[model samples]
Structure formats: C-alpha cells, structure tokens
Target: MNHEISNQLKQNQDIRENLKFLAENFSGKIVFSTSFGIEDQVITDVIFSQKLSAVEVFTLDTGRLFQETYATWDKTQIQYGQKISAYYPNNKKIEGFINENGINPFYESVNLRKQCCHIRKVEPLQRALKDVKIWITGLRAEHSPNRNELEILQWDEQYELYKYNPLLHWTTEEVKDYVTKKGVPYNVLHDQGFVSIGCAPCTRALKEGEDFRAGRWWWEDTSKKECGLHS
Candidate 1:
C-alpha cells in the first residue's frame, strides 16, 4: 500500500481499538456529537453496533436547521433507540447577539460569522464536551481543504481532550454505501445537493461540478468557508 493509505488504515484501526479501550478505561466520560449528516450516520453505526460504553450521542439544535435535518434526527433516534441529546443556543445570548449585530450580520464579514457560530455552536460544543475525556467527531479528510492532513485520532488542543474521527479514512462513496446497506438514518439533504449541513441561513446547496464544501457559506471566499465548528 502507498504510505498515505497505510497511514490512514493504521489511524483507522487505532481509533476503533482505542474506542474500545476508552470505553473500559474511562467508563462514563466519552461523548460523540452528530449533525445527522451521512458521515455522522456512519460513526453512529459503529458506536451502536459495537455497543460502545459511556458514549453519549448529542446534536446541536441551532433552531435554524432545515426541517429535513430535524426529521432525520428524529428518525435516527427511533431507529437506534438511543437518545441523541439536543443542545440549544442560550436564548439570551442568541437574542442579544442578533439584536446588536442584525439577524444576518454574518454576511458582513467572516469575523461576524465566526462570532455568531461561537454563540450558536462553539459555546454549546464546549458545554457538550465538558467532563468528557474523549470527544468523537464525524470529520472526514475529504470534507475540507484543511482536513486533508487530519488523522483518525489526535489531541484537541482547544478542548484539551483526545479526539477521534473513526471514519477519517473512508471516502464519501464508502460512507454512503455503508449507510445504505445498513439502513442507517441520514439527513436527506445530502441527496438534494448539500454535501454538508449546518445552520439553514449559513449553508446552501452546491452547484454541479463544485467542490464538496462550496455549498456552505457560499457568499464568502472559498478559503473562508468554515464556521467556528471545525477550526
């Protein structure tokens, strides 16, 4: 195998093995966050199939998600019978921020967008990750330019926790095949041209022949496409 693929396989194997180890070693402190996307569904299947311990699944209900996304979240809960905890932005913070900056100030500049993302997603992520030693995410290397070098496992400097991306090595096609074959519940928006789903106002559908992430934050330059969630 090429060095890159070999490294990817090693990392992938490490995450699967480490997840088992952490479930036993850490017992009630591991958590996983999902956004009801295809990638999230694949990871959800791993945890559900393995019956991983202490793995609390959660989602951020930004109150601005597409109705289809919420419907998928509900379907996923019913299919797995595992409660996916919902986190909402603090009402006071959201209201105050919108009042001061206008409802869509994110269109003004990248900084404003990040500030909004911090209020809606980042802060909630911090709270979700609190007391959790291992944080599992649905990040894939193909999702973004910055993520091409990401490993299946790494230490999150900002959160001070061990991060795991079990599906990091899998291609998007493989992810879809697994979800389809396993009958895993996923956001239907993926079929409608949204490769990635975030808040409704900030995300858009990609055009034919566009990059995977071109649909998200499309108004900004391609280099500045991310919300505070990943970076």
Candidate 2:
C-alpha cells in the first residue's frame, strides 16, 4: 500500500490531486491533524478550499496556545466553515499532573517535560487517532534534521497506521509563499519570527541564526528538545 501510494505521489506533483486521490481511495479513514502553523494553514487551505469532504480536519488544543493561534483558527473556520475538530488534553490527566507536579514541573526535568507532553499531547492524539487508518499531518522536511530523512509516506508502527506527510518535501519559503498567495488565514506569529509554534510557554520567536527547531523548548539541549509526538 505504501509503495503504491508513493508511486502515485511521484507521478503527480500537484498536492490537490494527490489529496483527492487519497480521499477517494481511503474514503472515511483519513484524518489530518493541523497545528495551525504556516504549513498546516497551507494544507488546511488545500483541503478546505478544495472541499475535500472525505478528509477529516482537526487540531490538538493543548490549552496553552497563543491567542494569535486561536484567532487564526477562528478566521480559518469563518473563511472555510467549521471543518477543523479540536481534540484537547484529558482533563483528569491534566489536573492530576498539575496537582502533583506544581503546574510547571515540565520546567524542572527532562523526564517531567516528556511526562507533561505525554499527557497533554501524545495521549489526546491517541484518542483522536483511534481506528484511523491514514493519519495525515503538516510536517515538512525543512523543520528539523530528524524530519529531513522521513519519506512522504510511510507506515507508523507505533500507531499501526499509514502516516502521510504531504508537505514533506516542501521548502520553508515555498510554504510561506503559498499561504500568502492563497490568501489563507495564518497565524501572524510567523511574521514575528515564531517558527513551529506549539504551546505558548514552550515556544518563542527564533533569533537571527536559529533553525526551525530552536523556537520551541529553547532552554533545553538540542538533543533533548523533542516533545515525543513526532519523535
């Protein structure tokens, strides 16, 4: 299945047609998770603007998002209608962690940080992806060194699903240009140098020479920065 999908993608470089093909073949099993970043906005535009009704679009609300992100999401729904579903962290798990760890224990240790991420992101994602077959994302190759090696389509053993990163080969500049040209509603933080925006407390604007990965978890070592959702 992966090989056939890869060959089909290789044969057609048009993203819209590729997505349409997936929707036609996969039907109701395709789920796309967007974080409302530039790349995600681009993908959202393609899916919504094109009216690919078979693809289910959604977001993971970590409850720590920037106001700009919420505004962008609102604008997007206004523009394209309310097609994006929101999956939030488990309330019980969130309460338990905060009560035991003082609300910000993620700042205290790497293990604690990962634990927080697991509760706030990974666990909620597990629920969103339950019984889902084709898990789509807005991941791009320019984001990190680790992501640069990933193929456009592959099987995820962890979730036992076919993970499809439709924008995997796109450049950062290409993504920015597409969003601008499409008049897509995007988070204004990108213009302010905030790359890869996630939770507000964990994200920051990139400095002059920092890479895409530098904006999030800036205080930690580069090797330990991932929140485990992608890693």
Candidate 3:
C-alpha cells in the first residue's frame, strides 16, 4: 500500500475524518461522484456536515435519469447548501448514435448497450475525472459480486486516479440506517425496491432474494451488467 493509504488505515478513522485528511493532505484535486443513491447520500452528508473544503462534488446527468433522482439531487443541494456540479453527455455523440440506431437501441444487443453507456455515462465520467487525483465514491462491497474484490483504496488506471470507496465495508442495511439517522435525502425508488439506480430504462426494482445489482441492466448477462463507470 501507499504511505497515505497505509496511514489512513492505521488511523482507523471514520468516513468524515478520513475524508478531511484527504482534503487536507492529498496533493491534487479531490472529487466525489454521486448518483443520489442511499450510499452516495451518506458520503455526501459526511462531506457537507464536516464542511470539507478543496473537495469537489459532482454527478453525471445521463439525461435518462428518473424524476425522483432529480428531485433527490435538488434536495441534497438544498439540505447541504452545496453546489454539486453536473456533467452531461456529449450531445453530438448521442444524437449521432440515436440517428444511426434508435433511441432505445441499448435493448437490442450488448454492444449497442455499451455504446449508449459509453456516450451517456463512461464518457461523462472521464470528463468528470479530468485533473482529479483522488476520486471518492460510495461503492459498497455488498453491491455486486465484482465489487466484493475491490479494496477501499485502489488505483484506477482508466481514470488515472486513486479511487476511494469509503463505504466499501458497509452493508445495505447499515447504509439505510445511517441515511435515516442522519436524515439524508435519498431517492424514493429505493423504498420501492430499487437497490441500484441508474438510467431510467435500464433500471428496475428487485424482487425478493435478488442481488442488489439485479435491478440494473436486468436484460444483460450478470458478467456484463456494469456500465463501465466502475469497471
């Protein structure tokens, strides 16, 4: 491990204290990406409640988000009194793709789906991570089988930054409890069994015994569910 990661682990600090340490000590810019899910809301609360400076919080507006997601986004800003920057897809690229294929071409094949995701999510994420040295996220280990192998702090070569997952070890129940106790703003779809929220067309509510990630890209193979944002 790097000295900073080692030090932070040694300290055994809480989320806010560790984030404060990163805000003060990390050399380059620090940024957090939120989708306004319950996990992200908890981290947002930590950042805003502690008043951490030098930390930029932003979200990717895929243009296909649910109304509830937008409402939660507004509520988060109002509750924290912080401006969360919004990154959007390249309109030209989206228009070209849609014209060539169709609006919902993602439902046809994996390649088309990945293409839409690249234009809508992965590309915007690249723009968001530009010039950032430390990228904070609300990823939890329990969210997916792939995520279970991720460390709390790891290098993301695609983004060329250190990805920090503050809630890596946290469970869904724990996240919900924290959000409720802290009164953090979250999407109402979560209450309707939406374990993971993403673009409107690709997401749905999970049934009993379903994995947390089952709600996202339910039509795709389990191995190909992610939108390449975290991959």
Instruction: Give the best candidate by lDDT.
Output: 3
Candidate 1: where is the Cα deviation over 4 Å?
Answer: 1-18
Looking at model 3, the pairs that clash are none
Which pairs of residues clash in candidate 2, taking residues 3 or more apart in a chain or in different chains?
none
Better of 2 and 3 by lDDT: 3
lDDT against the true structure, per candidate, is 0.82, 0.87, 0.89
Q: Give the TM-score of candidate 1.
A: 0.90
- The best-first sequence of candidates by TM-score reads 2, 3, 1
lDDT for 67 in candidate 1 is: 93
lDDT per residue as tens, model 2, 22-85: 9988888898998899899888888887798989998889998899999999999999986689
lDDT of 3 by residue, 1-231 (tens): 379665684456488878988888764588999999999999999989888857889999999999999999999899889899999999999999999999899999999999999999999999889888899999998888898889888889888888988899998889989998888889999989898899999999999998888888898875647889997
Candidate 2: C-alpha RMSD after superposition? 1.3
Per-residue lDDT of candidate 1, residues 1-231 (tens digit) = 235533553545655565666576667788889998899988777777678847888999888899999899888778877778988899999999999999899899988988988889989998998988878899988888889877666768888887777888779888999888988988888888899899899888888899888888888885747777766
